[model samples]
Target: MAPGLPTPKKYFVTAGAAEGSTPLNAFDNALLAARIGNVNLIRVSSILPPGTEFDPNLELPPGSLVPTAYGYIISTTPGEIISAACGVGISRESFGVIMEFSGKCTAQEARAQIENMIREAFARRGMELVDMKIEAVEHEVKRIACALAAVPLWY
Candidate 1:
């Protein structure tokens, strides 16, 4: 690989959902809720650099190629509830890990599942958990519903 830019040092977690008549519209609305509707999302695998800073309210310029690890669920069944969740585990000595889950469930359930996944991931790597962040979203389908959770990594 050509020498890439340095590892990301900043990151943020976000989740959102929306209902629309069509799947695409619902996805767009959900992105709007997550505050990343305008950017070109480049989905990446889950890995956060050590020492990375977390920004609770970070905003990206429009059209930026944002890298993120995310999970999403879309449903068309009326009255069905769908949820998505993402979690990040920071390690004291190495890069952090991220886990995501999506399903027909409550936001709390999704969050709990991803938290367990993050803990297992850290334990598998024998890493010490220093901190963590989790976010989740739930949507009830009237026509179509979409839910998403993500960790957006910034340089």
Candidate 2:
């Protein structure tokens, strides 16, 4: 097989909320709050490689090309609440699934959407879901604010 990134053996879920002067800056600040701002995040589709372990304490270096599944919401309206959530559903011995959702809603609503999506993904694949990890955050916008949730896959 041609060389490529090795299958990830560990992963982590993170959530952050922040406000900034601009939309991009708000998102960036949210990333910083999530502890993943320094690395280059390569957005990937929803899939958790088999046998991957959840490591919430995993520390990644700056400037690394990290594969991630994430969701975020940026709202400029004052007093508006925006929420985002990311979830992973794992089977006993099979490749898992990741789900993400964002909207102008509460964090609990975003989390509920993720949970349903993950369940549907597993059901469609005929896989028995055994476990899940989820992260969610909400932001009340003053000027520009972002709520972000992520599942980062690592070596």
Predicted model with the maximum lDDT: 2
TM-score of every model?
0.94, 0.97
Q: Runs in model 2 with CA error above 4 Å?
A: none
Q: Using alpha carbons, what is the TM-score of model 1?
A: 0.94
Reference-based lDDT, each prediction: 0.89, 0.93
lDDT of 1 by residue, 6-95 (tens): 677789999999987789889888988998889888888989977888887787999988888998998999999999999899887789
Which 10 residues in a row give candidate 2 its minimum summed lDDT?
A: 1-10
Candidate 2 C-alpha lDDT tens digits along 84-121: 99999989998999999999999999999999999999
Q: Which runs of model 1 end up more than 4 angstroms from their true locations?
A: none
For candidate 1, the per-residue lDDT at 25 reads 88
As a whole number from 0 to 100, the lDDT of residue 111 in candidate 1 is 90
What is the TM-score of candidate 2?
Answer: 0.97
